[model samples]
Target: MASNGLLRECVQQLKSSKHDYEKVLGGSVEVVWQSVSSAIERHLRLKKGVGVPGLGKFSFIRDFQPLTPVFLLNDRFISSYGVSWKRPPPSLVIPIAELNMSVLGSEAGLPKDQVAQTLDAVCAFVGGRLQKGSASGRIPVGNVGFFQCEGKNLQFVFDPSFVKSLVQSSNDAKPNVKPAADPIKPTVQPNSVANRTSIAMTDAIGSISQLSLSRLVNEEPDSSSDKSSDQKNDKRDHHRHHKHKHRHSKSTPHLPLSTQSDTQTSTSTQSQQILPRFLMLDPLRAPPRHLTSDSKYARVQDSAYERETEDVKNRVARSAHEVEEIARRTKAAQLRYLQTKAEKSVLEREMNAFLHGQMEFKRNAKQQEDARRSSAMEYDAVKILPRDPIVTAAQRREVKLKLRRRLNDQVALKDDLAKQKRAVDQAESAYFLSKLQLHAAHEQEERAERQRIEREALVAGWTQQLAVRAQHEQLHPTRKHR
Candidate 1:
């Protein structure tokens, strides 16, 4: 119960610190609690104790009583001594968060958020690894302990050598100082039981001897007459006997009935005074009895019954509250699920429309590319002729008809060359157009590839989310109606 209280306190501290932690660790309180609890479990399993700088240590102690030789002698003896082989409950020391955030931040050599992220990552890794290895029995972790899984729970068994080493180290650290001397009196062997008993006996004997000598000195002188002497002796003996018996009764008030009766009879019968002697004797006494009123017992019983009833009522109330909380959360989760489903559908529709537009654009680009190629082919098929020099005139003057024919020939050649130049320009324009179309197609392909990648990423993210939701539901299943 104390451990549970401490764990709850620890969880609360971690939850409060989440605001100052990284976004990666800014999950629900339950997630943080689970992560922390798992981390603590793993730490205890790996090392007997885990020390987190600025956050105190979480230590595990095994609770068991070793069996002695006497207990091992027989089953009856073992049972009589209450020796048990059943596993003892674990003892855990949960750390309290007392150090300031600044101290942790400084120790980590990073900002608070980054430190939180690092710690979270470490916890997740360790916890996940341990959980995965849980099926294997007694996996050794360093030299401290072996981690074992009992059904679903993890357990740690400390190594005897490690424990011994720790104990030895602690003992070596302590100062060795001689004990102080006794103040009253010095004895040869002060620590020995025999010496103490002998010293007590000697002191008691000396006191008795002193009392006897004092009594002898205080006695009145004996009478000269035989009758008077006898009477004085008898009176003195009687006085001494009564005094001794009174002192004995006072010293042992709770003597048994039989012992008391025997002592009384013996005192009445004895006429001679017995000298006081020191004798070690165990007193025969009964244990004290207690008497309680019936009404008081009845009241106590009533109070216990009332307490039990109240506890039951509180448990029922808590159970009802938990059920209500679970139901509310489930409903909220369902609503969110519906909202996400709607969003996913809308995204899918948008993606499909975008892909259709891209396909249409690619088709137009292909058509333009084809048209440019056709024009280029046509230009390649055309032939261009070199321009001819104008015919030189003869030395003598020529006839008018002959000069007209030569001018006409020159004009025709010029016309043919101009047409050829026009054709060449058209071919060059077509070449440029084809190159532009090719570039546009390459851009469209790149854009399509990027969109495909984006779509895949979106789908993968949705799949991961769904998987997580399913796993969560599996872990904390709700009651199903028939």
Candidate 2:
């Protein structure tokens, strides 16, 4: 009854039935009471649907009664129109259990045993003021919701006049504002972009083909072949001459020292460019497999082969990191598993100890309960007498709290008093932090007004300790109670 749907429905019902609500709620007490009785009865008999207009549809189910002639359950099927919903039962609809349990958990620090006890206590506490959840009333645990008992529950009543007023208000509100007349615009026109890009790509492909055709027409194949033949004949003549001249020695005979130096510089420049590219390409592809060492034109290939080597190294590092993260996840999971196992073992041991403790508790409780039960049975068999004793015994505890308004006398008198046997105790504001001082002051005040209460509470404890001390004295005068 204190759920979102129920409270909202109750509010809407009250607002709709506002005119008749006062009359119905303020009628004779007898009439109102009779209406409640009749509503419960009518609710019990209903088999078909009955509308509560703004609230919901309700019906009843018949069941056998053990203690009475019949039992009728108040069943309401309230169709709540929203974006989406299912018709809920009253008990299922209420958030009372969750709200109270959550409240208990926060208040009591979520202890296991007393958590349920706190929840039950909180619910019982709420049950007292729930019927009072009217528009303006409040309750002890009002964080759950406000409770006001003044208004009627107008659950079954609905007025048709309110709906008409709502329609009329909607009609009257139309002419105050006008709708916008402009059309929304898009930034990029897809058709125009597609048409322009298609024409540009076609023109680029035609231009590439035309440029290639023009280069082929401008190039002369016969002249390139004649030049290649002449260079090969010149290379053969030079090699033959070098072979004849260098036959007498291991080193080739140089035409001049300057010519040898110029040849060495050209070879070194080519080697310098080729070695770095080889170092880069080796990691990406085993370049020796796909490339021939004799190919003198290897440097003319694409630069991506070199970049691929670095890319592969990056991929390897990334993969190593991923593998390490996976291993870390595995380690964390195993640690959690071992921790859970240890906790489970401890819980099992604690559970056994708790069961043993409960047995001892139950045994003591059983003996106490048996004594009370036997006393109750005996009292039922005869009349019991009440006693109020004439004697009043009290032990007085006198605690004097001394406050020195003047500290000057002590320091001044100390000049001569230090020559005496002993000096007065020295104290400072450090004494203000003593919990014992606060406790003593509190105990003194409590002891003054509630001496009888304190005596009643501590008499058994005092008697037990005192008897032990007396026995200790009897054994040895010099012995202290340990």
Top TM-score prediction, candidate number: 1
Which lDDT tens digits does candidate 2 get at residues 1-482? 22233333333443455576323322222222223233333432322223321222333222211111111112221111111112222211111111233333344344333444422332232232233333223221111112232232212221234234433544565676556423332122235543345344444434323322122222233565567568768978888646554557756464344346434544543543322444322222433433443333244332343454354445545544554565568668966876786677567546755765687699889999888877844656576689976543331211111224245566668766775523233333446557678989999988886987777779978999999988978989665545
> Of the candidates shown, which would achieve the greatest lDDT relative to the real structure?
1
Candidate 1 similarity to native, TM-score: 0.20
Estimated TM-score per prediction?
0.20, 0.19
Point out where model 1 deviates above 4 Å.
Answer: 1-117, 128-159, 169-482
When summed lDDT is taken over every stretch of 10 residues in candidate 1, the lowest stretch is 66-75
User: What is the RMSD, in Å, between candidate 2 and the native fold over all Cα?
Assistant: 38.4
Q: Quick one: how many clashes does candidate 1 have?
A: 0
Q: How well does candidate 2 match the true structure in TM-score terms?
A: 0.19
Cα lDDT computed for each candidate against the true fold:
0.48, 0.40
Error of 2 at 135 (Å): 29
